[model samples]
Target: MNARIPTDLSSSLKAEEDSNHSDNPSFDTVLAARLSRRGLLRGGAGTVGTVVLGGMGLTACGGGDDPAPTTPPAPGTPTETLLGFGAVAKSLADMVVVPAGYTASVLYALGDPLNAGTAAYKNDGTDTGFENRAGDHHDGMEWFGLDAAGKASATATARGLLAMNHEATTDELRSSFFLHANGGTTTLPRPAAEVDKETAIHGVSIVEVQQAAGKWTTVQNSAFNHRLTCLSDNIQLNGPARGNALMVTKYSTTGVQTRGTLNNCGTGKTPWGSFVTGEENWAGYFTRASTDDTARGGATAKSVVSLKRYGRNAGSRSRHGWETGGADDKYARWNVGQSGASLDGSDDYRNELNTFGYIVEMDAYDKTQMPRKRTALGRFAHESAAFGKPVVGQPLAVYMGDDSRGEYIYKFVSTKTWVAADANPANRITTGDSYLDAGKLYVAKFASDGSGSWVELAMSNPLISGYATYAFADQADVLVNARLAADAVGATKMDRPEWCSTNVNNGEIYFTLTNNSNRAIDSASMPPDSANPRVYEDTKGASTSKGNVNGHILRVKEGAAGNAALVFTWDVYVFGAESGAAAGSVNLSSLTSDQDFSSPDGLAFSPSTGILWIQTDDGAYTDVTNCMMLAALPGTVGDGAKKTLSYTKADTTTLSVDTYVGQAPTADKLKRFLVGPKSCEITGMCETPDGKAMFINIQHPGETTAMADIADPTKYASQWPSNAGYGAGKRPRSATIVITKTDGGRIGS
Candidate 1:
């Protein structure tokens, strides 16, 4: 669902990178020359090398002129161990198909009751009180166990609080609910009640769930069961932008607080006990009047540049018309137009757009506390915030990805180092305030030779201060317009970076670049780089799709400096492609028929087993198989050989695309573990501390069906979880499922 919005800034930024690097030789050219000279080294000829922060190089062998260690001093053993589970056959069935020994059951579904007063979900579209029910399009989620006293418990597996994000909505119209009047089009103003119901279902859900006798059920009326929507007043703004003049609005004239979180996609858990929810695709949910740009900025070049770079240009209408619901400020805030008094722009919601698109941190144990927007993490289309292994009295690192094509990866190092006593603290918000409230953010600039550097995004940087279009006034300005700062520093444009997970074993980081359609569309956009090595055709029914449709996962090894490391080595862990494609071409991993997948979206490493779970949200190769999830046992970087692909150009010429491919996947290494129902995406998953229960989210089933067929239940694209005997209807709904091994052993073992 995050890929729905088309990124307009992608091409412009790609073009900027092309022109910026035209005069200076590219990183590939420099690395190629270095490798050519190191050809004499027996094992270092074709492998990825390391590049230090100050333009120094280290060969794979220990013979480079620069004196940093050629081989990274190895870290301690990983916290998790691999539990090998045999592969499950791929399927397009209208059910969740897991491996031979696994059994899955619905724990909760959209419209399921969260309060004791609400009736069970009818699944017939007449259900209401979505404010007290499960939200739709569940994306990222995490588990925080609770003891009998209702505090954060690390090992309490049977009873715990499950916090999950409801990212977006499915297109299936509800005929019974009045919300579907006129097909629920955003072109016209919607009814207030209809809009209120829709708004209530678009945030995060915190529910208390328990498993007894192998059955998981929601604890209705539990105090922990609550929902936070885009309309909740309990959300607060923190960090440097808090109380800043740029954030003043009618809702929060002091700029210290605002209403709810929006479009929460991926989620992360802090070293202290809290949930870090990434707000993504939130820019497309606000409306800007046709004349808003010039009137708001008033010829200020910096203001205009910041507005356009964040896709807040005038005449832009969001995907919904919540602004048209009524004259109330609750709905009016959705419209970011300059309609009211303009002297300070505080009478209207003109500054409301600046409030969203942040990583919101919430204390899972303390529901009374307000959610804080960690603005120090830089504002962008954040996909996830993964913290590296914390060291006592050492700095903490949080990695994040902006989930738009041609965006950059970011790292935030806390100003306050980690203190061992802070872990499992009595109050997580206080811990968050100490570490997350202040930090130095850095953007990644990857090179072709499997090496990279972190460019700090500071206002003190000459490149940021001297940026021609946007002038940086202070740290807050740079944080507010993070994309501009990343562009000024020339960070490597990734292919829609998504969920990131740090290897608990070695503190190595991995992120999903969830495909970019703009790359190589023409000479105007970016061509395939060594990092993103695919720009081939993937044909679907009568139409051919280009660009990296089948996305890949990247592995990063930080230098011995650990969380604060400025230099790192990297390589592609695996490439997503059709199994039957050319062995070494599009299917770079040499996947077989049963192991193939596309658009690797949701990626999580099991804390108990260390197995990597890769989920897909694909339309590229859906004709042959539905979206699915796989279990992978990945080797470290540089475990495989270099790869090269010859691309036949439009003019009948050929271009060679060479990249560092990781070890080839085998049946035992990476295998399909589960296939989702038709039209659904397998997004988020989490495991119990004991590793007995695994929770997975299936989102947006029956999404492809036409809204006009709402009256005909038979025309629905899927009847999942319901047909699987959970709910009672032919309509499909997003639901959370629990998977466990039949033998009562740890999952995937």
Candidate 2:
């Protein structure tokens, strides 16, 4: 009765890295004759010193003559050290855990109705109207405060709207309330009902939440409560790639619109108050027949090259096969192959694949507004976007990372200088169009000397135009085929870049380069660099894997050039390893029982207390402990010393390398905060403006449950957030947990 479980089914396997290579540019030593960290404090402070005073416009800056504030900012108010709550013990129980004086409660969960008319979730795979309920697999999210009139308020802390992306569905055995029946997979064209149900649960959810008596709960029937699914008809196409010929399809003859968003992963908050949802792993959701690659006209030789590069090669099967259902356009649009009569691909759904993989902007406070795909930001498995604090009359900058093995990191700089009046705008999407719609996208190229450059991907660049293979038409083509363009310009392929977080007090950026198995597969393979400096075998239970299984975090300092800088210094902040690993080679952080972790994924910086939070999405270390979240007080890039790494391969070959490693973590410096249940990933977090409450997401519990015990309630892999002493059920659900201090004080204070 159960479909065969895929042995290769993985949540994080996006792409192979060795396919692309970067011409590592030569540069001088990072810390040699250049101005040292101490020299900056004396005279050359520039943007680095100004940012350390509380970012671009977040705090006031004065000259030397200006006196300091009468009193220092409060301990929990974005400028001081974090020394409030004791570290929580790491746990594997099927429940949310917190520090001693904090409480964790489920605010909203999968299948929970947002409006009054919808029925509660049945949790039996028979429920309907998922478009009106909270979606599944909550990931990237942001908090938008609501004013007294229920409009978008940037200041209100107690009441606001939470917009979260439902990344993807769960495995059937691991989760009982999954979308389809009989193991949730079928080769025969999927049933239309199952397809519709699945589509309804894979987008963004906006729910109104408020705190009363120190506990937060959703506001039932609130006008702000809404769900934007993969089936929603109001998603509009915008920016350079809006009306391109490649985007034309039967659904949109003018290529001006698309139905929904897919694989919404990491997210960002726009300066003008909007939720920016990034599309990750969306290429796996379409079907392309084998013969389509040989077709003429719209299916040219360039199409074949681009499709294969993007992992949508000929004969590729859709992830869930919604295109295989009944022949209606609703089902047919999921197919992205040549079956149309028109030459420009307007008569069929061949171009439907071009409509996705974008950064979508939605007004969380306003439900009736349509979501716009800001294509100028460039696509390619977007993980998260972080904007530098805006400054008046200065260019706005946004940072991004492509979440695939051997992928490149990117940044976008707007042509127009920011005007302070636009911060509190009447229409946010209009403001977004002014800035995000017209920007120059650039890919990063990291050098061996601990410095890096941002290579512009515009058509005007000779490197992109002179590339002989793929044809470059305009800016639209460059943005649409961003990965190819990045490859063309020789951007440095990273070790699976994921969530990016920036300090509130300074513009220094930190991102997690989650483990990559392809780093050292053979003698000819790309070896470890200073940024990704590990190659070893990490065996969990019976499964064994080599390379950088326990990933590391990369820290970048923008220096005097600021966010728009082309050259910046970089170093490895910390390396994830077991407590018993070799000191200088593997266990660089010198982790102890309470601080050791593996494969760091989700990352965020507290705007209130300047603390860095690290979460895990790891299979490499699951046997030793469940996935967890940790908090640390970060120093700077050069605070660490350089060390050498050595590894012995299976073929009896030995390799040695050197990398910069951070200071050893003490009990007070880095410690585990909370741990999730069995087979779950801890991701997507946001906090109230007052820093009193925090919201974190737990995704895909029991994902490791075997297919044999799926139907038995007692044998279910995990009964979390529910049976973990919160709700009542045996089925596991991905839900958001709210953590607040029990004494009504600031969190971590």
Candidate 3:
């Protein structure tokens, strides 16, 4: 038996962006003057007009006097680029220009069909079986292999299981507009067929893939390949939220189970052979009943408070509008309203929104067991939870980041430690249940001195209970609305926390801060500390549009105490910016042509190879280059030179400069390995256990391009996998690409 699929259904939606955050922080022309020094480098083919700001000046970019390695290997070969940058070149709109001797290719993409019976995908937005095939918006992924002869273990480049999260589907392609679908009300409610198909397309899909010779192929016959969708009929809930009064609805009077999982995003591959897929952005799926809110069950004001914190309650509009379609509860449940005379919770089953945003677990090698939602993890827009292989009796720990504008990062330490994988089959799932069912959920509070603390959100903790902003109910409620709880505890609001990955070797953690425009120099926003130091205007495109710069990666380590209770030290390992931007003595690493990026999104630490794969989906710099992925060898959290950043506030209080002591993502260190199609985001990558093959997901190839414009293939924005000749024409699909060396050599050196 392989992984189980989660059936717990409820209501959840995307975390709402805090409107109270700093909207636009004003920056001076001086910062812009510094960026002007960045040299504009030309991009490769098809990027005639693309030019990037390279070779940042002021000694900070290339700040070190280190020379290029005397014995450099051939170009396009795996010569692991360390986290601290060296002499790598950064260019605009170009082919992946790596350090030397590294090779890269598309392993999979959007429209490729997995099974033998499925027809080939047409790159056009129009394609049949796409629902049963691969969905769009691929995010986190993992690689698991079958034990075989000559299997290279970590080095095995042959075959394995590929599991992925679909994240969010864009309306730019599928013609489903949230506010207005067709032209009028007649076209309203969207076709039930479309809603069903789209809902069916939203969950997680696990498939077995094989690498023969140098090419990787899908093993369609493998029973392990299964799909989990929101439309699935038999899924149930099994956490603190399950059977809770909040989860009660018309569908399940017992409140023990629900329907399906949605917004399945960042994922974690387990030491016990299962995968944890988090449901994010689930709040957008429901419509709150406005009228009888106070009357139904005569619920208290606090009951409604929970709904609002999680993006539910009365006056909420259904983006999908599936509720307007029919009188049957199947379609009407999406409406989320309480009405009628029936004494049961079924009358106007609106509380369905309470059932989403959970971390679901599934075994990769087995398919007979349904996926299970491990509720103890505490829900939000969970990005990913990374854990190392468990040793017998060790605390089964996993790290996570909530993907929202002002969310916090977390770590789950199991009450029951680890046991051998198959030593006790009878208590296997039970062991997992006990460990994850209840535990401490801590929010990160980064301080200026480079040390941070995991503030406990347990209601009994003074930080949570004593806060005046909101009340922390219990562990279940704390997990249900973790964001609000984290905010009340004064958790450090980061630059949009995205993904968290712990190194396979040293257990160090790295997380991506995907840009935050809400940051400012004001007291409430960014108060200019050494951690979140600079507050500058990052203008978008050719104009001075005010917003946050791309974003940076944060690395942290535990203090004296190795447990979650101890304070941790941290540093900004790398900041996303164009080399042409201004800089002083502070910005530690000297960014060059080979290693400059904006908005680092997907973060991965390949345990087999000890390589950090940093992928980018940048709006701040996409005008110059396509979204890209790079490889880096990261040092421990505090392993870099320390520099201070100074900021002067209007209130006459001078903010001392940020003190950064970290390795730079230099040219020779962080080099681009691959770039995505023109209008798409390059996300989700995993290779064979042996390192011979790589699987990269290209999501929404023509995401930003208009549908009307994409109708003509010749004028299409992205020629992706088709351009690489995986199939026929240049229709772009968000499928996973299988990348391997032509000579079948080991990946990144």
Candidate 4:
């Protein structure tokens, strides 16, 4: 979710476009019948007891699961409480706020010098060399523990490498105003210097941080401090589509390599000790000429179909206008039109757009190693990749979500079974090659009866083999244009699926369905469904927003076979809403002011405590307070009964939908923990092995400031770390904060 662009211009941005025009059935009608037959919707509301299955699976690589409890409690021992902190109140202040006994301290921020050789950041628009400094808009992050000797250590608590994604920069009118003097140029032919700075800040950053004397500080000039900018080269393309013709580019004639990873939104830690991130909203960074379709053989051509299907229709403009930076190769690569003399696409960047939208893997500890794009995962607007519980002899599974209005959820199962010893192998990237390089990709098809199945997205599948819209060439084509394949297989369309996390205790998976603006009850294009059953109006000041104004969290329990199970059951873990909304409808979660939240985005389960940390990147609820994070001790699926909801259309017609509701959470089970500064989104969370310290990212404070007001400190929407007495200037910046208990106990305890 790039908040840099205002909502009024969303329709013009290809990345934010709703491209799904499939005729798949909504879940409303079938779900009502299923709930009625089961007698679960009898009393309007009910609570059902669910049986817990034993033999919880192992954590996937980078699924962020803490170590399991050492051993079961002795006979007669008392059970431990799930949560032990008071809820923090909602806030609209311009600073970070936490619960009473916790201390939130700033550890790293945008423009901060990563190495001693780089001069200090003045916080003004005159800073340069962003490739050697902290990138902007920090999002998903993962902690790679290190030993006292500066070696990789899974249990290290005092020192580690913080690898995170700098998704995008704050921009206005196609210019990154916050990064230039006089707000730079907004017209075409963008300056090369401004474009260079903007490009360097939209990738990934890995920096070392250490704790000494009860304080956390970034280790400047450390060997692990490195930046992979948009200009970085030598990124390997591994998987089924590595050397395919669709990937050929002037820089990589063999189609085995590509340039830097762009718009990385989420982070993962591989089971083999590597950092994995997803390229999200990368389609908007490339410009396609108006004559591209004609030059590539018209609208009926396979290349033209792919370009349009991925939101890169002919005549689309780049987000930052980077293509007009001159004729140099660095700037020319941004233009993804057909301008080459060869038909193979080896002489130009016409195929460069095919190289991104992947789950990129890199070793956080090895600065010399290049990141590898795992193409077998199936490319799209990937939000994040969360692995399932690893079973030693069973195939490993990685769950993913395509973050768009009507996209689908996906999973990739490795061909090779997992081996426990490989978790700590000598070479992490090589180990990734064994599992990530070859896999069977599947898209979820959720049914109306609260059941779902994983449909394979391979050439062998009849739906893809006989797809009428787009003829498939080979396996590589299916992987490169996976959205088309998913549609051909009749996969369920989700309401902007964002992040996926695996519960460590039972191996159940949870996905965050961030709100969808295009959803409607009466419209045929996108009607309300059982899985995504909501359409309401929320007013913020003088404006009103329709559709699913607030999102919800959906959790799934695998079948008897666990992660490898093709069949599964699902339920709405909670529907985000205002505390005062009508119950059994919008406020289905029954959340009080202390536990209410909207547009749940970032989700992670504490590996040590089993508490689920939920973060928000919201716009609907900003009128009440800034975005916040909450901690919850969630129950398993099927813990609650089913209920039917009816919506009144503008024409007075009744539209009903039956849905499975999870057990209602009390303040004790769920509570707000932190709220970020004004106009900021609280995202990306991780903790130390012991769970004593938690790291959270606050992104894009003061993002709404007008470009003309760049020099006026008072006109800024916010002055965050600076107002909090950090750094040198009044400019707002995205930064990472470390939270710890005052009494030296584990967080959330």
Best by lDDT: 4
For candidate 2, the lDDT comes to 0.73
Q: Which candidate number has the best TM-score?
A: 4
lDDT of 4 by residue, 1-749 (tens): 75224743464463535777777667662111111112121111112111111111000011111223456558777344556566666667677777655677788999988899999999888999999899999999999999989999999999999999999987677788878877889899999898998998889999999999989999998978989987898999999999999999999999999999998988788788898999988888898988899999999999888888788888888888898888899899999999989989999999999999999999999978878999999989988788898889999999999988888999999999999998999999889999999979999988777899999998999889999989999999999999999989988888889988999888889999988877876666678887888777776667677778789999999899876788999999999987777675678888877788888898999897999999999988786778989999999999987878875666766767778889999767898778788888888989999998999999999888888899899999988887766787888899998988766778887
Per-residue lDDT for 1-749 in model 3, tens only? Answer: 00001111112222243422322221211111112212433333221122221111001122122344466558776454333232223333223233232334445455456677778765443455655566656777888676455221333446577888776565532233211223113345566556665665677777777766545677765666667777665556766666666667778877777776778877887665567787866776777666756755444555465566666657666656667666766787776666656554656575676677778876655656666677677777777778744657666667787766555688777667666753334433444566667667777887756777887777787766775555666666677667667766677766667777887767778888777654556545544445555556654455542334567788877665454444788887787766555545223465654566778888888765777888877666766677777777767787786666555566655555545657775544566666665666767767776665677776666555444454466665655555545565555556676554434454555
Each prediction's RMSD over C-alphas, in Å, is 10.9, 9.6, 7.2, 7.8
TM-scores of the models, in the order given: 0.88, 0.88, 0.83, 0.93
- State in Å the error of residue 322, model 4: 0.8
Q: Candidate 2: give the clashing pairs.
A: 78-608
lDDT of each: 0.75, 0.73, 0.60, 0.83
Model 1 C-alpha lDDT per residue in residues 25-88, reported as the tens digit of each score: 1232101101111112111111212221111100011111112323423565323224344455
Q: For candidate 3, what is the total of clashing residue pairs?
A: 82
Model 3 scores a TM of 0.83
Task: Report how far residue 289 has shifted in candidate 3, in Å.
Answer: 5.4
Q: Model 2: what TM-score?
A: 0.88
